[model samples]
Target: MLSSIKRFLIGRPLKSAELGEQKLNKTKALAILSSDALSSVAYGPEQILIVLITVSAAAFWYSIPIAIGVLLLLTALILSYRQIIFAYPHGGGAYVVSKENLGINPGLIAGGSLLVDYILTVAVSVSAGTDAITSAFPFLHDYTVVIAIVFVLFITTLNLRGVTESASVLAYPVYLFVVALFILIGVGVYNIVTGQVSPALHTPVGTPVIGISLFLLLKAFASGSSALTGVEAISNAIPNFKDPAPNNAAKTLVAMGTLLAILFSGIVVLAYYYGVQPIGEVTVVSQIAEQTFGRNFMYYFVQGTTALILILAANTGYSAFPLLAVNLAKDKFIPRMFTVRGDRLGYSNGIIILGFASILLILAFEGQTEQLIPLYAVGVFIPFTLSQSGMMVKWIREKPPGWGTKLFINTTGAVISLTVTLMFFLTKFGQVWSILIFLPLIILIFHRIHKHYEAVGDQLRLTTCEPSIPVAGNVIIVPVAGITHVVEFSLNYAKSLNPHQIIAVYVPFEREEEEIFEEKWKKWQPDVRLVTLHSPYRSIIQPLTRFIDTVVHKASESDYQVTVIIPQFIPKKGWHNILHNQSSLMIRAYLLYRRNVIVTTVPYHLKK
Candidate 1:
């Protein structure tokens, strides 16, 4: 039943190693990866006014120039990352970048940043999409958190179901967003050029024109840079594409870049021509929609498309996180469980984890995408710097003299994006301090994980052949939890080991253990030996440890070895730590320290 439910939630998984380069076509991969950046057209302009609204309503006009500068930077970064595909076509993405030039720590920092960024991408994109919906229907306005959660769950369920299914579900809606924005902007532009354009349904907002300064201009540029948030998503997710991996990656990059540029510029122009003004906590698009279409079908249609597109953009993260987690797992930054595969052989566990984290984040932030927006961009830009930086290294290490043109292009992109990275690190430094807290925690997870891998790697590492120890009689001691079920299973396992002695060791740590265990195991038909070491302190682990040492000391003298049989009953459905506690851990630790003893486990898998 659990397997079936898992199947239903995650979908039929895809083959993990079966992802061939030529398998995924360029157009499909582009559509999937480009969703977030393309959907930025919906809210990138909105963010500009959101920031400046505190000072004056007139700051909305400045959104145009800010978006333009960001757009230019976006183009340069795209060209830079393009060089990345040409160089290291593996799924390395940002890690390839940082590792190549900046060293391993910086590579990990890039990894940490990108992982956080993908999570924020889901929260921000979905919340922003829903915000667009609230623009049209105020009835759904107060329920953004609920809506975002439901949306994340929905995507999670689909993603767990399978990648292709998730992509296919979101593909059309993303396409719809692109087409609608293109058509609306195209119509608006054509009307203006053909002299059929009229003033916006409302007057152009020029009143209270405040003098602009460089600080304000830099702020605006930073705000527009939000459009570049998902540019690195493609690089992370290129491994998921069909065959012709490099070609598909490059093609997807170009396609994403083109559509992103078009939708963004078009939205800016539409906002400007329509004189769309900003309302704090109100949507720029909705205000313009009401003004331009005034309850017409076109307004509703465009608004709906925009909202759906935003929600689907979360798919990009769904695709990338599982893939990135696989990389992290390989690096030992995450659990090998993340590297574990499902029926379809994909990293289903990682996908589900990513989905759950996104949902929690969406709810925690109250589904306010803009509130999470500042936290989002900084990490993504960091990876952008790393990826571009890595590509520069890739070029330099393998460069010929005639590669000047390529070097020049990639170098320029790295500098431009790295500069933006620094600005965001500073301009957003105070406001986005929360992410600083989160980044270290993630990095530490990576570190602990790396450290664990090193430790485990050392444990599993073999330098020479083990000294031949002649086989002799061994004691099969089963440590029961003093429960009815534990005793029954322990005896069965002890018999199976076929050891010299089959005994059930129950440490009477507590009075209850004495009473309950004495009454429980009083009648043993097969006469299984019950060893209860006294612990006046009522500590189970200490008594068990002392008992084990005594058994080994006696057994060694008798030309016999000890095989400690531990019966662990961990129900399929129970709080993990609460049940396992210190007993199981201490037992494992003690047994592992005694290499001569063969510690065996008898597990009772009960229903939830």
Candidate 2:
């Protein structure tokens, strides 16, 4: 029944041969990979205004220049990641690039930082999407966190179905959002040009609370840099593109960058002209829509598409996090389970884990977009710097065709990204200090995991000089609660092994029970030796294991193996099994890692 439900939700499993069909084309790929970057225009400008407006509404004018600075950084990243896409077509993004060129530690740092950013992307994007919904229908305001979590779960399910399926489902809304914003920008520009509405000339009524400084501008820039959070996703996901993966991925990256730049810049320009303020539940984009379309169909259309694209933005994280995790797993820096693809050829474990982590952040921050913004950009930029720096080193070492131009571009990107990272630390340290601690701790964890995998590999490695020898002899021990068909079945199975000896062992809490059991056992006349282990503490497993240990020690002289057969009764109903003691399970678990000790279970099925 559970399997049927799973099949229904996730669809029938795809064959390994169908994996090629799962790769996305350029059109669908842009929607899936660039939604996060494209959708940021909805709130990216607002974040800058949020920081700038603290000084006074007049200072909000600085948002345009700060946004341009962010744009320059975005341009650098897009070009740099294009180099990455072609250079490392297999696609590990910053982690692979940094590890190969920089070192192990830097690679781990890049991987860890990007992982955090991906999680934050899901949280922030969904929260902002929820905010959009509540903005349209304010009564849903109280359920913001609930709505955000529901969206996360929905996207997770979509991704679990497969990448191609998710892209197909998510593509429409992203395109709709782009078109709606473009319309809004066009209408606003026409209105300004034709004198339908004048440029915002009125200063805010409030007095300037604080004077503007270089620090203030830096703070705003850092906040707005969230626009660049998902730019590296395309490079990380080149493997997800169709044939000619590198070329297709690079083209998608360019398309994403172009759309992102136009949408982000247009929205900022319109907001400045319309005098949109980040003062209420209404977003800057929402305010611009209201001014241009005026609560009409186009207004709600923009709002609906904005809400959708923001929610779909999390699909970018879903797409990239698993790919990066698989890379880390291949390097043995994370669990091997992450490398295993599910029936859909998706990394189900990584996707599910990313969903849960994002849900946790949403809950922790109460699904407030601004509350999560401070924790957003730093994770992404650290990787940006490392990836760029790694590429710079690669160019200098390999000096491939056009290496100098590539080196210069990456060097500039590295410097800009590194500066942004520092700006985040300096300006928002009070809110984001935990990230400083988190990055190092995660790197330490990666090292520990790598070391553990190394130890496991060393132990499992085979050598040519090692001898292959079978066990000299076998002794079987069966633990019996009482004489029953279950015990008979276990004895028959043990006899089939034709071991050196077989013994039925029992431990009793009281003397009277032991005697009664012994008498019944003797009456049965099974012709097998019975070993009664007396337990003062009434612990069944301890006494039974000790007796087996004694047998094993005796058998060691003759090079005999000891096997413990456990008889289990299978209840007809799963719930009925809980009524019985699980001593068989406990015994098997305890003896699992013991050398030369084999544990087997013989089951007797019950009708009712």
Candidate 3:
């Protein structure tokens, strides 16, 4: 029944050959990969205002300059990642680039940072989407965490269905969002140019609590840095594109960057012209829509699409996290299960893990986008810095064609990215200190996992020597609770193994029970020997295992093997099995790690 439900939800298993068909064209790829970067426009400008407004209402004027700073940084990152795509077309992103050019530790740091950032991307995007919904409806404000988690689950399901299907479903909303925002921006700009709306210059009404300084502007820039969080996703997911993957991915990156810049700049400009503030329960975009279109269909339409694209922005994380995890798994930095593709050819394990991790963050931060924003920029910028640094190193060492230009781009990106990272740490360290702890913890875990895999590989490695000799013979032991058809079935199966000897052992709790069982066994005979073990404390497993240990020790000394046959009876229904003690299961669990001990189960199905 569970398998049937799974088939219904994700569809039938896709053949391996169908994998190539799942690669996305550029249009669909944009929707899948660029949603996070694009959706940031919904809240990125607001984040800048949120930080600046703390000084005083007059400080809101700094938003434009800070936004420009973020945009410049975004341009540098986009160019750097394009170079990343051209160089590492196989698509490991920063992790692979850093590992190859820098070293293994730097590679793991890059991988770990990106992994955490991907998780936060889902959390922050979904939470911001929820904020949009709550802004429109108001009543949903109470269920913000629940709504965010449900969106995560929905996106996770779509991704598990496969890449092409998710892209098709998610692409329309992203494009719709772009159209809606452009209409809002175009009309808002028209209003400003027509002298309908004037610049919102606020005069000082009282003493400023905190005066505007360079530190404050840096804080605001770091807040808006969320705009660039998902820019690396395209480079991380080059393999997900159609044929000519790297070229297609790079072109899509440029397209996404262009749209993001236009939308982000337009919204920021409109916000300044209209004097939009981070009002309670209402978003900056929502306020802009209300100002431009009032509470009409266009207002609701803009809100609806903003909410949708923001939610679907999680698709960026869903698309890239699994691909990055696959790279780490290949290097034995993470578990091998992450590399396993599901029936739909998606990395199912990675997708599910990303979903749960996002839900956890949403719950931890109570689905408040403002609270989660502080932790968001650091994770992304760490990888951004590492990726750019890795590319810079690659150019210097390899000195490939056009290396100077590539080196300059990456160097600028790395410096700006590192500056932003440090700014986030210094300005928002109170809220973001946990990231400091988490980054190193994640890297340590990666090393531990890698070490374990190395140890396992060494142990399983084969040499050119001859194989060891086989055991002389088999000594089988069957543990019986009582004389019954189940015991008889196990004994007959043991005899078929042609063992040197077979012992039927029983554990009796009381003297009277032992005598009665012995008398019955003697009468039945059956040409087999029976040994009885008395348990003074009524411990069945201990006494039974003790007897088996003695037999195994003797057999091993004689160059023989020991096989324990556990006799079990199958009930007509699954619930019926719960009514009986599961001795067979217990025995199997206890003997699981015992070396040189073979265990098998013989089932006697009950007719009724």
Q: Write the per-residue lDDT of candidate 2 for residues 1-608, one digit (tens) a residue.
A: 88998898799999999999999999999999999999998988888888877887787667778889989988999999999998899999999999999999999999999999899999999999999999989999999999999999999999999999999999999999999998999998898789787645424333344698888888888888888789999999999999999999999999999999988888877777677778678888888898898899999999999999999999999999999999999989999999999979999999999999999999999998987877787888899999999999999999988889999999999999888889888988887899889999999999899999998887667854456546798999999998889998899898888888889999988899889999998878457889888788989988887888888889888888898999999999898978988888899999997776888899899998
Residue 146's lDDT within candidate 1 is: 86
Q: Quick one: RMSD of model 1?
A: 4.6
lDDT of each: 0.74, 0.90, 0.89
**TM accuracy, model 3:** 0.96
The total of clashing pairs for model 3 equals: 0
TM-score of each: 0.85, 0.96, 0.96
Screening candidate 2 with a backbone cut-off below 3 angstroms (N, C-alpha, C), the clashing residue pairs are none
Which residue pairs clash in candidate 3?
none
- Please give the lDDT score for candidate 2: 0.90
What CA root-mean-square deviation does each model show from the true structure? 4.6, 2.2, 2.3
**In model 2, which range of ten residues has the least summed lDDT?**
200-209
lDDT, residue 168, model 1: 71
Q: Provide the lDDT at 541 for model 2.
A: 81
| lDDT tens digits, residue span 1-608, model 3 | 88999998899899999999999999999999999999999988988888877876677667777878888988998899998898899998999999998899889888998898899999999999999999999988889998899999999989999999999999999999999999999999999889888544433233244577888888888888878889999999999999899999999999999999999999988887777888868999999999899999999999999999999999999999999999999999999999999999999999999999999989988998888777887888888899899999999999998999999999999998898899888988898899878778988899999999998887666862546647999999898888799988999899998999988888898999989998898887557788999899988889888888888889988889999999999998888987988988998898877777899999999989
